[model samples]
Target: MSKLADNLNTILQRIKELSELNQTSVRLIAISKTKPVEDIIELYHAGQRYFGENYVDELEKKSNDNLILTQCSDIRWHFVGHLQSNKINRILTRVPNLDCIQTIDSIELADRLNNNLQKQSKILNILIQINTSNEQQKSGIEQKDFLSLYEHIKLNCTQLICQGLMTIGSLDNVNTEDESDFQVLIQCRKELCDKYNFSINDIELSMGMSNDYERAIQVGSTIVRVGSLIFGVRH
Candidate 1:
């Protein structure tokens, strides 16, 4: 196996260990942002099924790459960046294999996604990104509005499925013992379930990246977006 495969397998093995300890299944989104499609193909052959991209134009081109289209048919794409309203149609129409939007931070974005998905006769899985750290520069909704956005999507957005919640948390607190943001997300999920009468198991918490995914899994993160550690430093 190649170095890429080695890296991926190592992460997968660690993920397995963490999941086993936590008694929870975790999905790894090999973040392919700023990397070439060839790297993605290598990882796909190494048993990676999910990949995330951060740019609309990049995702459009990569998703349509002939090499990728022919080789990685079962591959899943996730938009792990800010969902700009202007680019929604581009993402919906161009990226046919998109599996989830892990950054639905506003009701307007949700409504537009729902409307566009409806127009395409498609239903999509989405995660409402919460600014659990309350960072001004982050691309997520404030934690206080999590309930309102969830309620709005539940009531009005017929084409969007609220699969889970996603967050980057605080850079300072991620790998440390702090996890206050993770706790906030856990609390938000509980509050949502409590108020809406939905099962807690129905919600997936997407919190974690390359440095701190193990801690995230320990705290109940169902999906972890890992990049540089697997794909190597981007050129």
Candidate 2:
């Protein structure tokens, strides 16, 4: 078997084990940012459906295949990056099966998504991006400001659906401490759900990356984005 196959087997085994312990099914999004389409195809052949991409251009190009493009539809393609307002229309035009836009931080961006969706007559699933590390330079709303934004999206926007929350943790230690951010993110999700009385079944918490996915599973990440571990490191 190829190394990719071996790596996949290992990750699946870990997911199964973690699921049993946590009593929660773990969804693995093979983070394919900067990776070749062939590598994603290899994993797709292995029965992996959910994939995450960081760049709009690259994601749209590769998504020309059987891959799902948008962040809300039948198949799952997560826009797990710092999204700008300029890119919203392109995303809506191309990727149809895009599952969730996981990095929405500002109301302007949210309004843009809503407007674009209305123009297209579609409803896009979204997650509010939280800066769990309190990093000013990061692309997320601080925890304190998330509730009002959530309320606004829920009440005003007909084309955008607020599914849950997403965040990128401070990558202090790739192996051990990285899960800290995911844990905090999970708390933020639960708090928001409680505040808004959002249904837990429909709510999602998209946190975790290649380095700390196992820990993310333990802490309750519905979607874990694994890039280097699955697609091999970008050059």
Candidate 3:
């Protein structure tokens, strides 16, 4: 097997081990940022179709080429980075297969998404970013403000659909496990969903990175964003 495939298989095996037959089924989004097209192709060949890209340029470059078309087009593209309103059009235009955007931290961005969705006549899927660790440096809504945004989005916007909540665990010196953060996000989702009377069946919990994905799965992470594990460390 190729090195990429071997690495992916190892990660998958670890996920299975950590999951331990839990009701939550973990999905790996092989974060293909900074990696060449070949690495992505190898992962696709190894049965990985969902890929996360932190940068718009990289996502466009890889997903646009026809030589690797199936690995790009047939795959699901997730935006796992901070999003800029001005850059929305570029991403929407290039990454036609963009599945879910995991960082909706502000209502203005949501407005931009809705406006663009109306212009393009497409419904964009998104996740509200919750600052689970309560860290200021993190890119998510403060715990106190999440519900207000959730209510506003539900009541005001019809173009952009909220899939669920996403969060980055704190890098601060704390004893909290990755699963703890993941569960906090899930709890936030449950509270909002119950209040709004929205169905949680189709919603997703886009938590976990390379380090804490196993714990994320144990705590109910439907999608895990793994970067360095699949592509090696980016410089």
Identify the candidate with maximal lDDT. Answer: 1
Please list the residue runs of candidate 1 whose C-alpha ends up more than 4 Å from where it truly belongs after superposition: none
**Candidate 3 lDDT tens digits, 1-235:** 8878888999989887776677556788898888888888888878998888888888888888675775445787889888887899998888768888889988888888888878888987788998898876778888778888877788777887887888888785234453667778888878877887876656788888888777777777877888888789989
Per-candidate local distance difference test: 0.91, 0.79, 0.81
Tally clashing residue pairs in candidate 3.
Answer: 0
Least lDDT summed over 10 consecutive residues: which range in candidate 1?
169-178
Task: Flag clash pairs in model 1.
Answer: none
Give the true-structure RMSD of model 3.
2.2
Residues 104-214, candidate 2: write the lDDT tens digits: 888888888998888879888888998888876778998888887888888888888787888887755555664667767767777877886766656778777778787
> Lowest summed lDDT over 10 consecutive residues: which window, candidate 2?
66-75
- What local lDDT does model 1 show for residue 204? 96
Which ranking of candidates, highest lDDT first? 1, 3, 2
The alpha-carbon deviation from the true structure for residue 231 of candidate 3, after best TM-score superposition, in angstroms, is 1.9
- Candidate 1 lDDT over residue span 1-235, tens digit each: 8999999999999999999998888999999998999999999998999999999999999999999999999999999998789999999999969999999998889999999889889999999999998888888988889899999999999999899899986977755777888899999999998997888778999998887887889999999999999989878
Model 3, C-alpha of 18: deviation from truth (Å): 3.9
Q: Total clashing residue pairs per candidate?
A: 0, 8, 0
Measured by TM-score, how close is model 2 to the native structure? Answer: 0.90
Candidate 3 backbone collisions, by pair: none
